[model samples]
Target: MINSIIKLAFGIEYDGTHYCGWQRQREANSVQEELERAIAKVANHVIDVVCAGRTDAGVHAIGQVIHFETKSERKDISWIRGVNSYLPADIVVRWVKVMPNAFHARFSAVSRSYRYIIYNHPYHRPAIFSSGMTYYDDFLDIDKMQRSAKCLLGENDFTSFRSSQCQSKSPKRYMMDLTVTRHGLYVIIDIQANSFVHRMVRNIVGSLIEVGCGHQPENWIGNILLRKDRQLAAGTAYAQGLYLMLVRYPLHYEVPQSSIEDFFLIPLLS
Candidate 1:
């Protein structure tokens, strides 16, 4: 007799400071590697997980989603505590649920959201959460950055903002929303999209910083989008400040959304 297959979805949170990235690597450590190992231990067999989105090295996530199939049946609490027991302190399984076969961690998603946090103080760099966020000493014009970011909304080819190493078949993505907000010394860039090419958010943030610092005019972003040339954009921003904040699935899936308040950095801005 064949055993029944069970599909499990997980909400993962991790600090990517010491890992190469989300994907497993041959040589370097990765969040995926650690997570798969932990989950396998609980399943009593090897299992692979598919994530909602892949994040780069030194990046972070508050609401990463993943799905895996297992024959071993266990309570939800068992999966969470068991897998977490084998995982490192920086990575944890926030929640787990039995998912329908039709639900896919990557494909079933409606949209994804990301937040980039910047420390804008000129005199001193934060020592406590130094590796968790980007430190930009230059004074930034919030109004200019806000105005420049508006051009990125809607569907468009983002070749100017994508990394050369990006392997996506197309450069076009539907930008659902993009906003720049400041709270005291913290500058936050929140963006939601149907999908993203590799390093697209960081590259856009770099260009916006140029506008915020008066190095690039407010219209430069629009011009670069028209040019569709990577050379016309600024260098990519640091990976530490970027977070995969949320992933939205259809209402029927009942996937839980991650809270931004769970992150330690949120209190500083609040």
Candidate 2:
């Protein structure tokens, strides 16, 4: 008798506050390391997972996706509950599904979405969920931020917004949508792209904040993009403010979509 290998995909969520990052590291704890260990315990063999996006340290993910191959057989419910039993509270396997071997967690993804939450009050700090959002004491001009964000829509070479350490072969990316909205004291920056270079979203947010704070004009964002100079852009924003919101795959794959309401307090955008 021969055992057949099976492929499974998982929807994962993690606080990402304590772990170093998603990838396994030699010296520190990582989200991938913890997850693999937990799944290994349940599978009775070593397991490796490939995530749709490898989020940096301190960045949270509510819609993370991953896939792995295994020879063991188990029901979807058993995979979820059994894996969670050995994992830390911060990391969780929210859903599981058996997938065709052709499906890939990262390569099959069509688009990735990210949300950055900012507390824009001057005096008081957010006592609740402080670790999940970034606080800026200075008042931000939401109108200015929104105007600057418009230039980011469509495909462009995002060299100005990419990190020096980025390993991507090209600086080009398709910006499907970019929006800045305000809900009470909270300001939200939502972005969707075909793919991103390292720290691209945070870097763009940093430059936009400069515009919102009056340090730079709204036109500055467009100028920065045209210049293609990293030094002309503002510093990268805090990782805590960032959240991996969604990953979309082709309809044939039947990958589940995640809801923003699961991790946010703001009203859903129309």
Candidate 3:
């Protein structure tokens, strides 16, 4: 008897510029559509994919995780190449592996980390039509931005920083960590949370930019949280600069990559 279910984890990357996002929509291009189509051709059957999180249009992911089940037995690792052959160059499956039957990619996630990159030089704006990153040429005070970001570290009603279009019933979220770092002209903002609401990260970045620009007092973030008003927040940061970096799960669900050691050549002479 052919096995009924084969659990697999897939690492995927995509240039979301032309797509409407990761989810399906009417006449809208999406990463999910491309992936499902590729899988159907290879497995010769319809398959449903479950992802750790949804990425908005123009966003990017260096380590996005997803899982799916198929009734057919996978023959070998060449499945990656076979799938890639049909998928667009912008969308590629890095690899796939059999996971425990009980492992779930979405619900089992413990945390998610996102990295936002911005170019802060007047002449260093992101490339034209570059939909995967944002460019802000004005000078920003990184130290002030970091200080303002600290007000978001604890659990709070993020209504102020969320999009008005958000459909989530509640706006409360616990921010695990938020850091702003500067490297030459690039300002990197890293955020970790148990979960995030729609537009939360972008809005937070927008608010921080306002503080960094001295348009708002340093205590602005705290005031917004206390105010709990969406109108109090600044415009959403450009979607292109955000990336879903990593998804964390319980220790038992930890993924192991044997070849990672080989990828980093340790000195044999040492």
Q: Clash totals for all models, in order?
A: 0, 0, 2
Candidate 1 stretches with Cα past 4 Å from truth are: none
Across 1-270, the per-residue lDDT of candidate 1 in tens digits comes to 777999999999999999999999999999999999999999999989999999999999999999999999999999999999999999999999999999999999989999999999989998978888899999989899989888899999999999999999999999999888888999988899999999999999999999999999999999999999999999999999999999999999999885666667667677
Cand. 3 TM to true fold: 0.91
The digit string of per-residue lDDT tens for model 3 on 1-270 reads 666788888887777777888998889998998998998788889978988888899888766788988877765476788788999989888768788988988888887888887777877565653565578867899999999888899788898988877888989888899988777767778899988999899999999999987899889889998999889889899888888877777877665322211311112211
Q: Give lDDT per model, in order.
A: 0.93, 0.92, 0.81
Q: Best by lDDT, which number? A: 1
How close is each model in CA RMSD to the real structure?
1.1, 1.5, 4.4
Off by over 4 Å in 3: 256-270
Give TM per candidate. Answer: 0.97, 0.97, 0.91
lDDT of 1 at 122: 89
TM-score of 1: 0.97
Error of 2 at 244 (Å): 0.3
State residue 245's C-alpha deviation in candidate 1, in Å.
0.5
lDDT, model 2: 0.92
User: What ranges in model 2 sit over 4 Å off?
Assistant: 267-270
Q: Which of the two candidates, 2 or 3, achieves a greater TM-score against the reference?
A: 2
Per TM-score, the best of the predicted structures is 1
